[model samples]
Target: MPFKINTNLSALDAYNALARVNAQTNKAQLRLASQLRINSVADDTSGYRVGKELEGKVTLMKAAQGNIGAAKNTLSTAESALTNINDLLIQIKGKIAEANDPTKNLTALANDINALGDEISAIFTNTKFNDTALLSGSALPSSSNFVFQTGETEKTTINFGTMNTLDLASISSSGATSSNITSLSVSTLETAVQDSLGKIGNYVQRLDVKDDYLTSAITNATASVSRLFDADMAIEQLKATKGQIGQQVSTTMLAQLNFQPRSLLTLFQ
Candidate 1:
């Protein structure tokens, strides 16, 4: 090869190699310090976009999760109220049956039936959750988004018309006579209780599924973001070490090459 002092190609090559090594070393160290794979949009544009989109979904899913929880609480409240009312109805029916014994006091039995009916009326008036009447046949909420889900809110209508049988006060008003004892029936109230309980159960089951699904989705989504944005500590440490060695070697080589043209003076000597 012909030696040229004016243009040291070998030195230029060595300098370029050093620059590459320096760039690699800086990148590795930055990744290690930040613990992130994508430091900027330019690092991984597509991954950045997709990860950001998933973050938004995760936020929305969390909100939906809270909504579902509130909905379940509401249903639970209504269910508890109905259960209490059902027990009271059972007591009223028992009192009516005992009225036929002729051994029990008819006036006392009538008072007991009237008291139970008053309790049932109170339950109908006071069965509420968060100040919203649940069993009064009023719509739970005007807004459809009250309990937001993935695409929309889950809407359910529970009818409480059978609650009408809760009143045994009229027949047993004057006395627990034979006519009154025979006419009073709590079967309708029992059926209504079963129906409302079943409806609440169905709503709870659906909410449980959604709750489980959201939990899984959040975990999976967070993992996806980690995969795209989190740095691999072991790999980054290796890269940083390798790049550090390359940087030292390339810098030394560049210095040697830059001074190598001085050897050409020996030819003149």
Candidate 2:
């Protein structure tokens, strides 16, 4: 190396090396402070984009899980109401059969039937979850009538059957007249309730499977995002320590090189 007084070339080179060590040290420290590998898109452009997309999917799947829970709750409410109605129908049928006996009080049995019918009507009208009616006489029964968004890119529809117009509360006509059992058709009403129960059971099974899948998908997606964005503490700490050591060594070398030019003045002394 040629000695020069105008410019200390050796010092300049050392200074540049020091600057590089300082930059590397700062990058490691930043990662340590933030606890993230990719703090900005500049860190890893492709990783950042893909990680954000995965995070968005996780959000949507979480919402879909919530929807599945709500759908199950609604079905549960409907099932409860229908089960109670089925029980009442059973009681009414028994009362009608007893009315045929010679010893049974026909008028009293008819009153019992009316009271049971009223209870069933009350259940149908009052059944609800979150203020949305599950079973009411006015709902009108149909197949796959109610819709619920149960998953990402998926939907589930349920039946909300109504028994309001069945006239269960007034099965026995004119207070003293025969029940006119054929006109009321308690058996048919019971069958409809049973069918709703079966459908609800099936729907719940499907929901359970779907919920399990969402739970797993969410877990895996979150892990993937973490791998893309989260910092490794051990690796970052090692790098920071190495950079700090390099910075110290480079600074010492720069100071020595900067002092070398001053030796040239000794000739004048």
Candidate 3:
């Protein structure tokens, strides 16, 4: 090799190697400090995109879980009201049966029945969830469908049909007589209460299942995001150590190569 004082090719190569090592060391240090493998889109383009997608899905699932909880609470409130209504109907049925007896005061029994009916109507007016009437035959929010986002691209919904309202006061017993009590269709009211209870029970079960699914989906999605974005501290520490050693050695080698051109002065001596 011809010795050149003006330009040392060996020194230039060492400098380039040192720069590469320093860049690698900085990258490893950044990864360690941030605790993330892909801090930016430039770190891992495909991984970053996929991880962000998974993160979005996790966020959506968490929100859906909250919606499911609110829906469950709404259904629970409605169920409680329906249960009370059912109990009142049962009491009215008993009162009607008592009115069928000749010895019982028909006026008092009629008053009791009317009072129970009024209470049932009050329940319809008072039963609400989050200031929205749940059992008043009103159209439910979200277009009669209680829609909840269960996934990034999917949704679950419950339709509280218009058959929810019950006007028990309209079933009158104005004639205070055994014949009137027997003619009253209390069985129809019982059936309506049972049907409403069944619907609410079914909806509650569905919401519970959806809530469980969303919770599991969020867990899995979070894990997926972690795998794509989170850094392995052990691996990064090792890589950083190697990069530091490489940088130190390359810098030392560059210094030595720089002195090689100075050794050409010895030839002139």
> In model 2, which runs have C-alpha deviations exceeding 4 angstroms?
137-144, 161-184, 266-269
RMSD of each: 4.0, 2.7, 2.4
TM-score of 2: 0.89
Q: Check candidate 1 and list the clashing pairs.
A: none
Task: Tell me the spans in candidate 1 whose CA falls farther than 4 Å from its real position.
Answer: 1-7, 137-182, 264-269
Candidate 3 Cα lDDT to native: 0.79
Candidate 1 lDDT over 120-228, as tens digits, reads 7677778777787776536445421233453224443434344433444453345344457646777877788878788778878988888898899888999998999
Please tell me which model should have the higher lDDT, number 1 or number 3.
Answer: 3
Q: State candidate 3's TM-score.
A: 0.91
Residue-level error in angstroms, candidate 3, position 123: 0.3
Residue 160 miss distance in model 3 (angstroms):
3.9
Model 1: worst 10 consecutive residues (lDDT sum)? 143-152
Candidate 2 or 1, higher lDDT: 2
Candidate 2's displacement at residue 243, Å, is: 1.3
Rank by TM-score (best first): 3, 2, 1
> Following a full C-alpha superposition, what root-mean-square deviation does model 1 have from the true structure?
4.0
Q: After best superposition, candidate 2 residue 104: deviation in angstroms?
A: 1.1
